[model samples]
Target: MQSIAVSMNLLEFAEPVLIWLALFFFVKSGRVKRFPMMTTYLAVRAASSVILELILNLQRFASVSDTLQNSIYFYTYWAFYISAAISIFFVIREVFLHVSEPVPGIQRFGMLAFNWVAVISGIIAISAALPLKGLGAGMVSIGFQVMRCVSILELCLLAFLALFIHSLGRSFRSLAFGIALGFGLQAGMELITSLIAARSSYLDSSMNIVLQVAITIVLGGWIVYFLSPEPHAEREAITLPVSSPLIRWNEIANALGHSTPHVVVGQSSATFLQDVEKVVDKILTKNSISVNS
Candidate 1:
């Protein structure tokens, strides 16, 4: 137990440090302008991590009554989980935009789909959370359930983007990818802790320490990733004709599991991408011309 407390203390101290360092480098990277949603999400996450640590410190060593300590603990629990859920949602949306921004039509589609995913998934997660009612249910237990739901959604978002990396011209943002990877690792750790808490009393006592170490490692990884420069964006070399059928492109995109959003237009809104072969031909021709000239 003494070792556990030491581990927790070390982890809590390191969290805000990692977060602030990552944020400093994130801003220095000039990512805020291009990824506003992700920047906002990171700010919220860093603040909440600090606040929750403060609350936990008060809960632990403050000379407060049991009632007051309990109140503080409950407040801290909900504050962390709620903020985490919201941050994950924002990161998913940010990644979607980053992955779709090269194509205007695809960006619109991804944004619309992201909105749908975030809203509908939130409702479902809340509905799942509702069943863990009663004072005896415990906030940690309930919050863990919510985290599981959020984890499933986070993984789904990552899976969607990862599977279509070849189809989409744009790549994931460095910040967005870091957040997702960190969150996924934390979620996995929590899920493991939850299972241990259910099955083994001994393991349950040390589960919080396990979670803390996992958090530290994940955040430390983020600090490193964010400080380093991201790769140059994938080139979009082939320009399609101006008069291609926008609706047909939309259909083709959907058929190819790439969404094209519906927008109001009289006869046109977005032009279509050329066929893969034609696009390759056009790019080769342009490169040949440049080389010859």
Candidate 2:
């Protein structure tokens, strides 16, 4: 028990440090502008971890009352939780946009689809949380449901990238793929831990530790990916096959919400009218000659 507590404390301390390191590398790699939401997410996570740690320490050593401490912690934790949850959607979107950057049409269409998915997921989460008792409990439930939805979306995004990697002409080693991979791993761990916790209350403590370890691994991986130099080949343009489904879908998506080209009779209107009148007069004269014959 002492060992487990010590390990958990160490993990808690290491997490924020690792997060800060990863954030530093992310900016150093010059990806901050490209993935602003992801940068924001990392900042939020790091700040929340530090604040929550301070709250925990205050509860142990400070003169604060239990009620006051609980209130502070509750509001602080929930506020950050909500912020992180919201930022994650945008983070996922950043990854998607980066992956589809080669195809503007697909990027636009995917963003629209992603927006609809987000709306539907929120509706479902709210519906699921409606049955819970009390406002506080319901809000917590909604957060969990919303995160679960995001997890599923992350997994789907990872799968889409994997399955269409060739079609999209993207390398697996690209930064975009790295971000998706990390999120997918984190999401998968959350889902598995959630299932395990649901199945047995006794494993909840173990699962928490496991989840933290998984997160630590993912953050470390992200740090390495951001710090390492990318391959020169990755920068070269890729040519997609004509028969690729990605190309076909991109074409179809491009065709959507666009009007057919129309000829505009602007300054040439008078000349066009004169030519049309001459052709009509000639046709009328030919018809009149035929009728007389």
Candidate 3:
């Protein structure tokens, strides 16, 4: 069972590694500027993994009290959450950047408000982990409670972001895909945790590796494909004329099969200014005019 668990973890790591490689190539090729945010998220995830290993060693190799274990778990978990929260914010920003319509005047203001909320949440997560002396007992402290409450508010904000992005479905296909998978894994993991009534401080950290690997695969592949030089070049080369040029007017007016008025220059007498004036005079006098000139 132990060997199986390690093997499973190894297999899970492959997907994320592939994702990282894909995104890495894209970043190197200048395919995506947003790669940095996603890359940083993965780095934080790697750090979380290291922290998880240390915690496990402390439990297995060294003697640590359950309370201390729980405390360490809370700190590491909060760190993961903070990192994840920031990552989600960047993802949402990417979605907005590709919004089908220009950012609304209201959304421009909302973005500023959202940034402040993100900052406040990051600070709160750090504060929550700052137990009195880094013990679980400190979590019941006033500061931690307030921070937790704020974290809940941040959670609500994510819902709003989801709805906002949903309005831009046509343009944000890649981001929408990543969010669907990332959030789906998150929800499934949380549901499993609650249903099983089992809590492992280390469990979430390990799962994050899996989630990161999955994200790396899906988002990384998408960025590479969509941001490839060829596709970008094609997009840049597309010339959608806002106004028809003189050449277009000539083509439409003179081109065969076009419905522009065809004036028979020499054959039609109505094509001349002199002919038009003579016709008008004739109409006024109720008489005819001879074309002598």
Q: Which one is best on lDDT?
A: 2
Give candidate 3 regions above 4 Å deviation: 2-7, 34-36, 43-85, 135-172, 175-293
- Residues 1-293, model 3: lDDT tens digits: 57657756776656546545544555565535544565565566556656766785687876889889877777776657555555656655554443422334334555666678667765665676565574544444533444344434434444544564433332223433344444444544444554444466656555555544544455555554545444232223223233424235434434544466778766664558988898888786664333332
lDDT of 2 at 33: 77
Q: Per-residue CA lDDT of candidate 2, range 144-249, in tens?
A: 8778778888899999989987677887877778888999999999989989999999999899999999999999999988987777755656667787777878
RMSD for all candidates, in order, please.
Answer: 17.7, 7.1, 16.0
lDDT by residue (1-293, candidate 1, tens digit) is 78777878888788778777777777887777766766776787778777766766774666787787667767676767667666676776676666655456666766777677667766765566567776435455556555566687677666766665545543454555666677777878877888888898778658988888898898788777777676665333323344545445655555665566889868544345545667889999999999999
List candidate 2 segments past 4 Å from native: 59-62, 128-135, 233-243, 256-293
- What lDDT, from 0 to 1, does candidate 2 have? 0.86
Better of 1 and 3 by lDDT: 1
lDDT of each: 0.68, 0.86, 0.51
Could you estimate the TM-score for every candidate? 0.65, 0.80, 0.44
Ordered list by lDDT, greatest first: 2, 1, 3
Give me the overall lDDT of model 3: 0.51
